[model samples]
Target: MKEKTSSNAPTDTELKKWQGSSVREKLVQLQSIFETTKDAKLHTIAIGSSHVSFFYLSSMAAEEKIYDEFIPKLINAGEKSIKSMLEAVDSANTGELQKVLSEIVSGKTAVFLNNEKQVYLITFRNKAKRSIEEPNSEHIIRGSHDGFIEDLESNMSILRYRIQNPDLTFEVMELGKKNKAKTAIAYLKTSYDPELLKEVKRRISYIDTEIMLTPGYLEEYIEDDPWSFFPQMLNSERPDRVISNLVDGRIALIMDGSPTVLIVPTTFFAFYQSTDDYNSRWISSTFIRLLRLASFIIAINLPAFYISIIGFHLEVIPQELIVQMKNSVEGIPYPPIFEAMLMELTIELIREAGVRLPSPISQTIGIVGGLVIGDAVVQAGLISNLMIVVVAVTAVSSYVVPSNEMSTTVRLLRFPLMIMASIFGFLGMTFGVIFILVKLCKLESFGRPYFAPAAPFNLQGLTDTFIRLPIWLKKEKSNKTGSGIFNKKKSSARGWEKNEN
Candidate 1:
């Protein structure tokens, strides 16, 4: 039989020595890929006998850069000559088809010459994006308002601008076999523990899914206790917050399309912290920290505590308030637990509704929904006045938490405690508290204690945790265990004031 050749195959005369597969075959494959994509743009230039092609995704690749800078460079160096093509864009050369596809996926233009095996990749990914603004959810009165947008490179630049330390490093990886989302794990080389770094990367490596597009999706996989109510990592959009955490020996996970970065090995106290805490005076910050801790306690346990007192331990109530409390619940139709759940769920529904609505409408929904509903229920006698007071206080306290994840967790923890308190009164509340404390002490974030400094009882950590001391006193230094707690400085800078001179 005579040799058969396909029409798409290059002729014997057209054959040229190249490092990769035949140009015609690669072109056929790439053409198919381009056909699948809606915005794939390919421009081919003909040389005397050979050809050169530029392939890019119009949606992601910057057209101005491709045409004005890159193509001009390639053509100026002489697209007619293959040697000029190689010399012009010689930096990012890749022979593998997989690498070419990877670059293309990352919004880089890929150039293929007829005779060369390697593809020339030029990066001009679309830079026109949302400007860094204060994260509406995490706004602080005093601090850099520049928050992270959905661009990973921009976020990295923001971090680099703030933390100029040489030890700061980022490890970028392409995750998801099908989705191919880019993610970077950033940490200080000399600060964060090598073992914890390994563990973070190791957990990420184990992620086997079709899509890993969001940080939240990744967070679920790497958490120490997925079943636990507490968040293992802290979500932050503020560059200042990320920088402070990084300086204190924490690792940040930045995904390409996420405004929020995940800070790992986060402690229970971490969620309570805000950027404003650092910007404010130490005494005021300490007082506010204590208040937040109190709010956290009240948010999770206030309703439960009320139910306990009303159902079982009214003796603990002061003499003056006994009749008032009794009168409040006198005509109520349901038990305290039933009404507490009703109010809690109602608030949750309202909050969720507000979140789902547009900004202007959301604020209206929050204020009107809360006030109207609370007032209506109290008037209709669906919920008692005292119960309404407790629920309102609880809802307000939950909102005081700086971390939304922790806020949600706090709200959720309210119900179980409420149930326990209503059933067995004060004893149940005590057991519930003990159980939560035990879990908190036991819970770990990337193998580090979630309830650190308190569980391990480090005095230095307390200065920054329960209370804020002068920055000069509390310095985060690496201990032998790599706990990353604030160690007392060798000598106080303010000690000079003590001298009579």
Candidate 2:
């Protein structure tokens, strides 16, 4: 039997005093603190002549290791302290009760020694997690299939394997007051801007929330423009994508339990880029990049442009097209705006259904909703045949975007543009275009221009924006200075030619 403290009802200050005279008193205090939780496991065992108390969360801690390995080894070791008896792969001694509790919650077994007034935190965390698999959203034709997993340590290992440089540094901090989530900020120390890093850290520290569920939740707090439709930070599940951004002097935020990592200070063009671009030939990559850019424009304004030209600016269309469009819309009851809205809403509903249902069912819903409903609506004379064609083309174009967030933004932006076109014709679309351009120009990602290598144009950065130049032609420069625009400082990839000859 171990000694118990005299004070039965200890104050908060007394409870915090980890240097209690008796291990039983400390154990009682901890038990009282976690009495409401049924999963909390406290086991009392004898190690040598001293009494040892082990505390861990049953849901998270490895029970097999504790029972099979730790207990057997501890009982066999004679006349040894609790710390000396256990042969854990990793162990740490701490006197603070708060630290001990934290370790227990984090899936480590906390061993309390009665004789020494010391606590040893042993790591035996073996929680089940999803194996690393290719990301469904950011799929590529020819690249590494591996992606970030829900496990933070595994994600860190993936990053470390790609970039083995000493300059790759990670600064970790916990976020949220009640549900503390681990977050790590990764950057290349040699190339990343010190000011930018400081700003990012400051913003993270400023976040005072009760719970952070995902990286997306944290993103809203850290973003410069929360109201803007455009995403300021790039979210990627691919380690290759994250590694590429890190090499470009950008900072990456990796949150525990979230496969998606956020890369900061990104430009609009970055969202359009796919991992396939770097893997393919430069000319082919350039063509695909340009095609995606064109898709962005078409996805946003195709319906609106069609409405404006047919309704108000029919003179601009060739006489034969005007005649064809007039015949198509002649029997339709609703105006161009109403017709467009109906189709858009239907498509959105189908899309939402597809997402919520199972994979096979979702595919069925897409085919049934798209083919059956769309064809039926046209045959019923509810929507014009030409309008169906226009909407179909627009939907296909939106799918071409590499980033899902950007694709969503493109989908949303067309509604307002369509309304504007209905009221003011071609003039409304021009104003809408200008408004979007100005917003993009004004938007900043961590104080760096969001519409980089374009508005406030940098001629050099243009090399890889709409068209990717050959890797050999690409120059190495500080990301802080160019800010996505290439500068005059260049390196020759053919410098070894003299030695070869």
Candidate 3:
């Protein structure tokens, strides 16, 4: 980059200082920059009477593109004809030495032209990338199966396809130091707050980190609360999910080489909701949401409740079930907390193992390993069958949350609650729940309510927080200003009913 350029200037648009005003001098400076790399190819090729020099990285397989698509199409008569041919193809002339070097490093071909007033950058970047396919973790039976690939341009195209509005904006920023990465942010200009977008950009700008390999890296750096267990930002692989929130006036952070995108200013309820919820009937969707909420409760509190009952409040167990439970735990040498922790950690270990192993073996390990471990634990009286049932159900319930980050938070929140329950019975669980609620209410994601609706109690937000409204009852929300609050787009979606009446 140019020494005169502000150090904080985003690398994507920043210009680099040129060595001289000639094409040959620019090529010499380019070679000097990559003097140590053997993969860098700088050559002088003749076209008619004129010889122009070009520079590219050989490792990117750009030579084939230059010969196949570039040379034959553009180089017949000389510099003048070359200029005309460049107008027909995707190419740009940049005087910034660093900009051209960045393009070359990223696999694009840079040719010097206009006597080095500007370097011609042509698109010869790697063409092969992961095909758009369904995301494994966020798959839905009734929603769009297409997910984002590692390429940022392709992801932006997917978003554009779904949101064809003119206000939709996609801007790229260079993140990391020494090894800068292209990080992009997408949002609808009219829908989101300009100040909010500015703050996001500002935070990204001031970051002093050297690498941002994934959206997670960006999320961690920019999130408001680093110490909080709750994720202030939501990460998702589904394009439909991202666009839905994008239309809702949220910002999406995308990184090159990472499929995951981070959506900011998300509420707690967003994690509990899914794309399929809209695809199904409203009644079914509401029911499923309720089920998920119930699962959330059960997942975090089930084992803890068991500990309270067995260790502190035995009388709360029903007389009919008391004998079965007592008999089951009678032979166990450890306390309820011990058994609960053992089983929970074991389940987490199995999950991690399954994830790390190959697909075929992971499935086998999750199923066969879980079954064998549970059966053996119960048979040996190390863990009760009742406890096994509770742990298994809890594991399933934690995974019910659509967002994996939130799901993990739920899994982790269980331990502290379990410890509290074991010590003070229902009272400890009460404190735990109260503390979590207080934290949620107090936390803010990008200066927006993280808990949302419930904390501020916006009636409109609440309408779709716990239970979604029927499609017929739902009205479109449009933000004319930058408030990012719900404003009725129209009087009604079913206004025909009033006319008929």
Number of backbone-clashing residue pairs for each candidate, in the order shown? 0, 2, 0
Model 2 poorest ten-residue lDDT run: 1-10
For all predicted structures, in order, the TM-scores are 0.91, 0.94, 0.91
User: 1 or 2, which is superior by TM-score?
Assistant: 2
- In candidate 3, stretches whose alpha carbon ends up further than 4 angstroms from where it belongs are 1-18, 478-491, 498-501
User: Which tens-of-lDDT digit does each residue in 1-501 have in candidate 1?
Assistant: 333432223234323322345766666667664555668788887655668887888888898876787656656656455555555553388876667767776788887777667778877788577987999889888878889999888899999988888888999998887668889999887777788788888998899987788999999989999999999999999998888787778889999989999988788998998888889999999999999999999998899998888888889999999888888888889888898899889989998999999999999999897789889988888888888788889999999999999999999898889989998998999899999999999998887888888987887667678888767665556522334455455545567767857
Candidate 3, 1-501: lDDT as tens digits? 323322323243223346444676666666656666768887777776667676888888457777776776666545678777765667787766566666776777887654647667777776578989999999898977999999988999999899889998989888876456888889987677687788899888878986667778788888999999999888888999888888878889989888999987788888899999999998899999999989989998999999998898988888899889888899899899999999999999999999999999999999887899899989998999899989989999999998888899999999999999989999999999999999999998888888777887777777687887776655555332111233455447666767884
Between candidates 1 and 3, which one is better according to TM-score?
A: 3
> How far out, in Å, is residue 142 in model 1?
1.0
How much lDDT does each candidate structure score? 0.82, 0.86, 0.81
Q: What clash pairs does model 2 have?
A: 460-486, 461-486
Q: Please report the TM-score between candidate 1 and the true structure.
A: 0.91
| lDDT, model 3, position 286 | 96
> Which candidate achieves the best lDDT against the true structure?
2
